[model samples]
Target: MSRARPFPAAATLGILALSACTGPQSALDPAGEDAAEIAGLFWQMLAGAAVIWCLVLGGSVLASWRGRSLWQVATALKVILWAGAVFPTVVLAGLLIHGLRLMPGLRATESDLRIEVVGERFWWRVIYHRDGAPPVTSANEIRLPAGATVEFILSSPDVIHSFWIPPLGGKTDLIPGRTTRQVLRPTKPGVYRGACAEFCGASHALMALTAEVMTPDDFARWLQAEAGPAAVTAGPGPDAFLRHGCAACHTVRGTEANALVGPDLTHLGSRHTVGAGILANSPAAIARFVAHADTLKPEIRMPSYAMLPETELRLLADWLASLR
Candidate 1:
């Protein structure tokens, strides 16, 4: 007999790497109760399919055997009927009922915490709502208390976009002039990755964010800090910001930069990433982003400040970094 070809090592390694699925963004990890339920359903369906496939294949082989008799043919026909017809109908019905039962739990009714997320062309405008307090604005990062149900009211100002955090819950669409909502109750305290699941525009692939699940006490502290205004500092950066006509589209608390065309830079320094989570939040990164935001995220609305002098760019970056 001819020898079989050996499996390629490189291909095997690549397949294994893909199957790892250990990232924080993976739905298979299931960090929350809702995610766990979804994952369980997926596994159940997969197992059912495998069982049916094996039964059908085994019956076909047995029926085609050269020595098969009438008794074997009858048995194979019976197996095919049960595995292909009865089994599928029963499994689908069960799945449908189970999914319907889980629907109410996935919906948001009333929550102690609510967050409004507006989807822009390639970024996220986040607003935190608290009782008897002014709304706090942030961008590209969502912070929530672990073990508490939080509601997210989502909307889009332009094209349709979808908000999805795989380890927490399902994808919810953000349509222009229409509002949608999703409820999440994370059971783990960790950082999870989120992204725009819908194709909106050129920079849609780069429209990503981070969800930080923290303890109740820590979340309270963070919320309090975020509600406050940016710290005041004396620097040439403020004058340069206004000189460059940046105030017409951005906002900085306690300053005259109250325009709303872009994300609020009032607490920019406190964020972990910039350029819609495309760049790390550092002095050097900020400088590059300020000069070449369009280069980092193509087709963005922000203009490139590549014409600015090196010193002025550095000064602007420093000023933004000091906002925290």
Candidate 2:
């Protein structure tokens, strides 16, 4: 066999690296107002650093070219003093001022919508607090209206978890028994990924969420729909879900399965992911997750339903998948 082409391998690696620069989770690929500001600051700071680097590099080259001359040595000392200290201080101060100006916008408490997000062990609980309605409860997904400022009231019930959606803005820490806040204004209607930036436990890496930005009209309709109860409450799946004691932990509104120990599954089927983005939402995925919750997401509070019969598991999955 012929040896692999070195140039081709390098090119492939370069392509892979470049592909990461623009994606759903990239901070540089900003889709929101705050993110755009952050990206601009990043580029400006990078340029300042580059200028400092060039000045120092050029001075070093001059010193090397004019080696062993006392006059040139004095000149090099002056160059080092200016390039290594004065230039960096001024550039850093300017960048710091630019960065500080962004803090007020991020800290602005006034918003068109207020969302309370509670971080659990390996999942998220989302509650929308609209002005004229009771809070709407959901899980694992966040929906926002494009071009509107949204204030996220964040907290963790157990450990510290940093909630971050890089394409939207910076990370905010969620501490137990204390509330923190972050505000973001999305300018584009698109799908993005959010994650728990802090390490919580065995399944910390799997703690992920999806954020979808919609138009004002579309978001209002979705929120109205989400406020209602499950569409399928009398099916065999509901029966099986109750029979297996899943109701003790989960709540499917408009039915007797009301409990607050776990996430509300009233509209589980409507969501795009199951097990907090570990699997796509579908009957097969639901069945697999129901049958082996522990294996799918280790250390989660939801116990595995492996003891349930295969037929009942199918019924449960089908019924849940129709929840939308």
Candidate 3:
């Protein structure tokens, strides 16, 4: 026995009233090559609803305009049973199948590069694994070869967090003691922003990261530079970095500080933002972050270094920025 109820004309009008909730224009909309296919299937579901709404509302207007009695609602009900209920169910089920069919492509199977992103209270540590080579580590920055499948294994050292890159895909949770993997193939060459979707603690707002998708050749060059050790500490930039005990918590390749407690600053100079992802990767921003990090993000494990003179802070920031 069929138990489906016919939808009313008013129901169709109600869906149209909510049509504004559909996909709105935004910079955050993932516009990757694969995104079109994803978006197409999504909008098809929306279109099905819109079409049903139009038919129901239009049929109501036609029925009323034809001098039919409002009591003839039974006839309208019969039409809705055929068009609204029977029709939409078929349409929606088909759309669901179509959307689900794209899942295999989302999951990678080819030779994909593996990168592990670890989220903490106020920072992100990105570790890239290369074949037959040592791991490359950096803070709040990730670079990948365009058109390659980069599988990101996400985890949190402490609390729960979420890794979200709007232009790439959606957010994936980073749970402590568990690894969540997200695979993304970069089709476009550009810098993409990411953030911690879930609030972990006081510095949650400041925790952010960036994905720098580049040409295969450009990515190769970056990897080469990262594999090398820091340049000679002859200048005031490297001099101040060492003399000030900055290496105590941070690590630069071939330097004394190899502690994994904090993010590796080997390539800090190449990043676009500092203090996690709260501020732009500029000299002033870096200086401000290193100086007032504790105040800017209260309860941060890092101590305030603002007691240093502005001139020394500027020099340190400049030297760090020159790292890349």
Against the reference, the lDDT scores of all candidates come to 0.87, 0.90, 0.77
lDDT of candidate 3? 0.77
Candidate 3 local lDDT, 1-324, one digit each (tens): 966555766688789766643332212355353455555655776687797788878877977787566547888788779776887788768877876787777666664689889987888888889899998888788888888888888998799999877666656899999998877776777877778889899878777777788899999998888888765445787668777888778887766656677778777777887887678788898898889889888888778898889899999888777777
Per-residue lDDT of model 1, residues 237-307, tens digit only: 88888889999999887778889889988888888888877887898999999899898889999999999
List the candidates' TM-scores in order.
Answer: 0.90, 0.93, 0.80
- So what's the TM-score on candidate 3? 0.80
**Arranged by TM-score, best first:** 2, 1, 3
Worst 10 residues of 3 by lDDT: 20-29
Select the stronger candidate by TM-score from 2 and 3. 2
Better of 2 and 3 by lDDT: 2
Q: Is candidate 1 or candidate 3 better by lDDT?
A: 1
Q: After superposition, how far is residue 218 of candidate 1 from its true place, in Å?
A: 1.0
